[model samples]
Target: MNHFLALTRRGAIALAFALTLPLPAVAATKIQHLISPGGIEAWFVQDSTVPLIAMEYAFGGGATQDPPDKPGVGNMVASTIDEGSGDLDSKAFHERLDRRAIELSFSITRDYFRGSLRMLKDNKDEAFDLLHMALTSSHLASSDVERIRSQIMSGLRRDTTNPNALASRKFLELEFANHAYSRPASGTLESVPTITVADMRDYISRVIAKDTLKIAVVGDVDPATLGQLLDKTFGSLPAKAKLTPTPDVVATAPPQRAFVPLDVPQTTITFGAPGVMRHDPKFMAAYIDNHILGGGGLSSRLYHEVREKRGLAYSMFEALLWMDHSSLVVGNTGTRADRAGESIDAIDKEVRKFAQEGPTQQELDEAKSYLKGSQMLQLDTSSKLATAMLQYQLDKLPIDYLERRSGIIDAVTLDDARQMAKRLWGQGLVTVVVGREPQAAAEAARAPGAPPPPKAN
Candidate 1:
């Protein structure tokens, strides 16, 4: 009620700042592990200070699990689940959520189906019960299905003309050919119309189950109560998820140039090659290396060279994007159509420079300092902590990841940074430019139709 609450005798602690307020702690956040009798496991952060709770969960199957025939079924399922469930119709369910100030939502990512719930502590039971209904007994109403389909199709069609969208879609097409990664997470115009209500039901039956679920809960809750709640919310699901087996692969785009020519003032470019996986032993080094290379905004090599120095593009950046099956050092920039060639050359110059020399001692030091300081901001909020806790589990990080993370980053030596730089950027970049073709591409296109000069002796 006042200052401290001994959550349990097992070092499970909570700082009860006020009756229902959570205060930021300068110490490491403590995580409690809970396993339900039904075999459901979840990570809990007990924070009774705030009369609030946040829950984030994900299943291994995301949009990638959509049938090759129907690209958006997973998305459709996410959209429809909260619309109506069991005895409550769409309007009734949503009205209840609104009246109670309970926030409930879902998303379909490339590799996971995610859900988030937030509610006042007093409304926890009703909020979770409603969530259980949506997950277990969604009605998949027909009218809702058609309306959502048309909405998605309209967006997909617009993507064809959106320059940034064109570049991003093309990059994926080249990066993950013949793989589920290549398929549109949001169904294509051709696929969404074919997605039926029955298809939504089937998607749920196959992917939403206890085996694939990972959860993180924070706020006025104890482990024992959470254990009971976890069982009640998830226990009824099937023991296993009948997910499609996705094969392992790497980002396949080589050091080559691909373009989607469009009539626009600016060319939007998305480019990169393979990157280290999240769980790789060298990821910490790579993370620091990347920060110096392109992850530091204007302080990054790519930004300083491409934007700050030469002004070739408005902005540029590169990042390590890790998926369940593949990893990549992806990046993007935008420039005037006519000057796209200049930006490409500048980006390549910086990448090759960093790959060869890595970060200087000074650069490495600064990067490490910034990265370490910035990390605290990421875990500062209860909602963010829940989301991060879920991600650490997904990334296969140990329970003490937050406590040990700073040391991991600080331990990277200059040699470590250099070696990681070479490993991540040595191959150079594979780029996709959307809008007018760069100069090289424009010249290459002329060869197919134009007459060639006589061969040199």
Candidate 2:
């Protein structure tokens, strides 16, 4: 077919639904589980809405899978995987996607290399074909390698002077110590240049295998066909992922004041303590306590104590960050250099208070209500729904997690919340401060930019 006719034919397949019309939302309470004929397992939610299909899958290797000498290899592969594949060269591959309105992309985090693909129902075949090529026979072209490497290098250079990047890196350094978590997810100034195309290929070969893969799918497909697509997209790979086993480690950031001196108008303070594991029975209680303490944004105790009551920092909040190796309750705030000591003192007082008393009954009730109501937003679209399903799989939660999520939250009694509060904040904080030396001894402690992509942490 001529180019225009090919485009016309491709577009015509979904034109009956006009390509832009949204199919009705599928009731998604029940997650359908299936094992492909090839024995590949995936979680599915059959939504024919909008003539669209979205698949999100992850391999257990990410930056952590990078060779010790090559910190950003996985990230570079994520950038180049679609640059060329099999018979299609870089430009040709992208053109096919654009012409058919298919979306396929990859990203790497600290723990997993993840990919997403979306397509009109009429184009699922081509979509899976392109994905298969990406997984199985990506060119990882030398020219593309240099191009992507330069981009990563540029970001690393900028991170050297970027205050937030500097602070985040330092925080991770303190938290993870010698673990892979201590390294930046993308690479450092010295690491990116040394990551060769061969290293990228080695990572791809060893990590993108069935034993380490997790998948979730939404929109316009049935199990049997999805099984075939899964086999086509992933079946040819080696069944076992040859990942270097990551060791178990805890964040070892000690309680004390530390600083990365930088000349800037305001100082940033970061603080954290050990966190409970996701699998721990007390996790839901702790999760709620975290929200009530600092994860609730302006509504949180940290916000009220530091920002509203004292006007110490423009922003302050904490979150429970979970990684394969370590868990932490990390928070950051920015304020005038002179106010740094006061801000730290304020935070310390609040932590002490919360550890002793936990959240008020009214606060717990409100937080639960908001969290329950917000679950709808999590499933508002096919892509997000697929991602949520993927997370459930990653977390090893049961397939009925969505149904049980509310009950889990509701089960956290006043005593549980109080116990969690005491448990989470009862330790000395590991604190890092930047922008200026913290003004006093009592103290301790502690993006956006058109500047560059964020350095991985």
lDDT of 2 by residue, 83-113 (tens): 8999999889888887887878888888888
Q: Which ranges of candidate 1 are over 4 A from the true structure?
A: 1-23, 437-457
Model 2 CA deviation exceeding 4 Å by range? 1-27, 438-457
**Reference-based lDDT, residue 446, model 1:** 60
lDDT of 1 at 277: 82
What is candidate 1's TM-score against the reference?
0.90
lDDT of 1 by residue, 1-457 (tens): 0001112111111312221243476126588787877778988888865777888898888887899988989988887788889899988988888777677888888778888887778888888999999999988888777777777788888998998888878888888888998888888888888888888888899899888899988888777777888888998988899999998788874687788988765778899887778878888898888778887887988888888777778777778788888888888888866678778888888889888998899999999899989887767667768878888887888878888988998899999989988887788888998886556445543667755422211
